[model samples]
Target: MLEEEYQKRRVLPRHLRKQTEPERPFSYEIRPATLEDIPDIREIYNYYVRNSVVTFDEKAWSHKRWREKFEHLQKLGLPFLVAVAPTGQVLGYALVSPWASKSAYRYTVENSVYLGQAATGKGLGRALLEALIEASEQIGLRQLVAVISDKGAEASIALHEKLGFEEVGRMGKVGYKFDRWLGTIYLQKQLNPRKKPGILKRMLGAGASEE
Candidate 1:
């Protein structure tokens, strides 16, 4: 889908494509996450879990669980990235995980980006999401989905829209948080449209069996 849209605009030369990469804010750096970053990531996420509707979890994640989650993404070769300040503090993180457990759903992934409470409104969320989208495409993912909460997070919703995600569906009052019912909004961005392979191509790909 992105490819189709790109073609509609004038095509950019290969070298020029890199120049079009989104510029990151100067004070912090975005990079692939390390195991050592897990503690900070968890602290940031736990703050939301305890104080906001951004996460549905009632309890904070345990250290063991956090380590396992990071390892799971690493084993799958999906991108898990963090934004860090020069002070070596983790400001935020973004990651892509398998959308579903089924084999046929392998090419599609769901994304999540969370910021430290203090880091909101800094354009860091946009920067983190853009990095995730690029990494997903490089790893040959075809679709990226964001399951955002429809509470007070217009900033998150707007960021998703700015990055090409469209509202695909919404579940009304499906979540209960902070003494009120909350809803979920699903937004999706098609990274690369999957093409149907011709019979010859399929045969070659499958090691051509006798008919």
Candidate 2:
């Protein structure tokens, strides 16, 4: 009789079997990242590095490394944003870096978004990416690219697609991590044209005029 009851429960429709209280809503605020947020951001990224193939980095980064990256992005005048809970906890971060060092690629950037383990699957990634796109556009960036690991990152691919990022290319078996081969999927999004000069262009113009 017990065996028969177990089988019956297993065959029942998912919704008809049982129900529990829905999860309470989560709240967070997105804003520009400050130096104080570096430790939390580094921790969030290192978790994936140590445990998952989402990032190809095999070693965890130190505080000094994160601080250097933060300062570099500040010098480049790029957007580095963070999501914070009302209780003042950093939940996630997103940022854009120069796509290429060439002067011709100044209008393009590569975007990265990482959320805390507890912050996943709550629509937080979507919010962070959207904010990054808007911020990049405001800074006169014309193109944004995302390089995502092809395996174990279906949700990331889907999120980028839903946000209008097109799959432009793929490179297979380029990265090896966790004792297995991994690949990358390249996604690109074109932003609206800017009406005025961006920070980089204005700075260059100032230097030229001074000379």
Candidate 3:
């Protein structure tokens, strides 16, 4: 019996013979962005800035710039979210900022989503953007716009279209970067209308009632 068992073990696949533990699945959580996540987010964005034409900006954003943007979004009560691995790495981020500076465009916002080089192709972008959309709806945003590069951003354009953003317009040679002229494709999504009064309106109503 012992000789037979040894022969069986010898013929078994090496991996099967070792009784190894199964690898933990790749998983992450989508959550509201915090101040601590800014550095990781900056790194992700700068990677694209340096390596691709996905963004028209030719220079990397400084930490100060990122912080300023973060604060600005917070002041506007907009959605800025992150996808974090179980190891606490920021895998990607999605955010919305006012589409235009004027009050008339308050309900409309432009959206941006970016993932780390190693974090792409794993559906993190979709999750982050979906979460951003849900959060924007919850906060009474009416529209979200995505400006994608006409070059080297087919995946981004496809992802936005898959999430219900329609092709609204396109501009050619509007941006010059990396010693070449690049264009933008504009995609817009109309969010679900708000069902309740916005915070400002609610506050005003409460004040009137108190008086």
Candidate 4:
């Protein structure tokens, strides 16, 4: 099968994760983040970057640049979330930043979700995103985007579709790694007026690091 075709066929349950589900009451909390969250966030992100196609960076990042990424997120009013276990282990995180810098594209944002090796499939991703959406929609973002790597086309794509993002676009050959061409999948969802982003929502991130 063609790579894109093969991925479109994969789905992650076709059901969105909800608060009252049996997986309810997980011991983690998702909150906005800052510079202190970088090392743990790097550990979560690098795990996937090294072993999987979840991110398309051509090389592993150094500490300085990694810290810079999160810093940029903070300035954009994006919620760089950390899903923390009761003991304060950083399980995973999700963040969204400007899809484009020009004012015309201000309402659009692309996102990233990364989890530690031990945290996959335990519903931490869902929790992190649930919190992310609540935080982002409060500011004024009209839409949210997930740029899925071609190799992970199944799980992440499926999850986004179930969460209401439609497959709006894709770009081929823009990413090269592991001796192959990888594509980018763009998914989006509209926000209700009642859920529009608010100023206070940005403040929610200020206290994100908690024990």
Candidate 5:
């Protein structure tokens, strides 16, 4: 399905089209990534980290470090996605990662969404997250986790719930950034329960669905 869609150049489902800009004012392409976007990604993500509780880390991540993290996620069989404007400006990114280092946790992954300020409230985060779920399922992942920040990110939290994720746990005062404490909200979604694929199995010509 993913390959067939990619070949046709369409990956989005209709219901997910909540905030596409007018007249396709916000046309975007979701493709495999390159190293070039890391700087822009860092700039966009650090903005939220510095200003909001969307993330708990206070320190700005360097592009190199971001690139390395991408490597790890890819190795974990997760694809990193970016939503870009028609002009190629990156609006946001989403990805899935292993929930734990143990082999037993391999079927369980975590999800994250980070968007630019200008992209907020425009449904870019939703798009990014939805894309990640599709990619995660295409790769045969079984579970997804969302670790949310708590200066109270109700909308972010609510979006996950609306998407079929259930709150599994919350840790109070486990995160300290921006001068105070932030709670960690853990949510999970089961992708599938039967088969699981490794990174190599999710490559372009891999098992992602040629339908």
Candidate 6:
């Protein structure tokens, strides 16, 4: 469907329709991402880059770029997770990134979740999201944000809202794809609120970490 059609109807076309029930029960596991998973992760991401407005990236990222991105996430101690099916295939992945560079925003993180074409509506995205939420909370993050494309993103928006995210903001015509203007929506979920620690307390703890 055209991006304009989606905007007009507020419904994903039948081809993009999500699964209402699993074809069969299959066990999957979510765990910290490994370097070995980069190729599969890149494949899934590049699919969206090429075919959908779900991402604003016009070109697929190079493998080197992906490697650097993953390494950076590792250095920040942020979580990168992969969902593996019973057959050992990667079903999907999720990760967090800095919302901004300033130290004052240290407790806030931007989240990304992607599922392989085969994995949607089977609850894999939900599983990855739940795991990410728990992991982020345990690591001291106080807020999680999702910046999602407004086109071809009904399922994504619904999923975040179901997970307690509130639509905090929207930016219209911020992107162009398929020869049409696209928009962006921001959703935020507050985890646990806490007072910022003083400098002396931060110096004595691992409180300087960004994740």
Candidate 3 regions exceeding 4 Å error are 1-22, 195-197, 200-211
- The residue pairs that clash in candidate 6, if any, are none
CA error at residue 27 for candidate 5, angstroms? 2.5
User: Model 1 residue 1 lDDT?
Assistant: 64
Model 1 segments more than 4 A misplaced: 1-26, 193-211
Model 2 scores a C-alpha lDDT of 0.89
Compared with the true structure, what per-residue lDDT tens digits does model 1 show for residues 67-147? 998987876777899999988999999998878765556677899999997788878999999999988887677889999
Error of 3 at 106 (Å): 0.1
lDDT of 2 by residue, 10-51 (tens): 796887767888977799999999999988999999999999
Clashing pairs in 4: 137-197, 138-197, 138-198, 139-197, 139-198, 140-197
Highest lDDT, which number?
A: 2
Model with the higher TM-score, candidate 2 or 6: 2
**How close to the true structure is residue 102 of candidate 3, measured as C-alpha lDDT?**
47
What lDDT does each candidate get? 0.83, 0.89, 0.85, 0.73, 0.75, 0.85
lDDT, candidate 5, 104-156, per-residue tens: 56666788787777778877777778778888777677888998886668889
Order the candidates by lDDT, highest first. 2, 3, 6, 1, 5, 4
Total backbone collisions, model 4? 6
Alpha-carbon RMSD to native, per candidate: 17.3, 6.9, 6.3, 14.9, 15.9, 12.8
Q: How displaced is residue 192 in candidate 4, in Å?
A: 2.3
lDDT of 4 by residue, 1-211 (tens): 9999888777445475343646545577776776777788877767667777768775677789888877767666666788888887888888887776445556677877777877888877777777777777777678788888877658878877777889988888778777888888888888643344454354334433222
Please tell me which predicted candidate would have the highest TM-score against the true structure: 3
Model 4 reaches what TM-score against the true structure?
A: 0.77
Off by over 4 Å in 4: 1-26, 193-211
lDDT of 5: 0.75
> With candidate 3 superimposed using the best TM-score fit, by how many Å does residue 31's alpha carbon deviate from the native?
0.6
Error of 2 at 149 (Å): 0.5
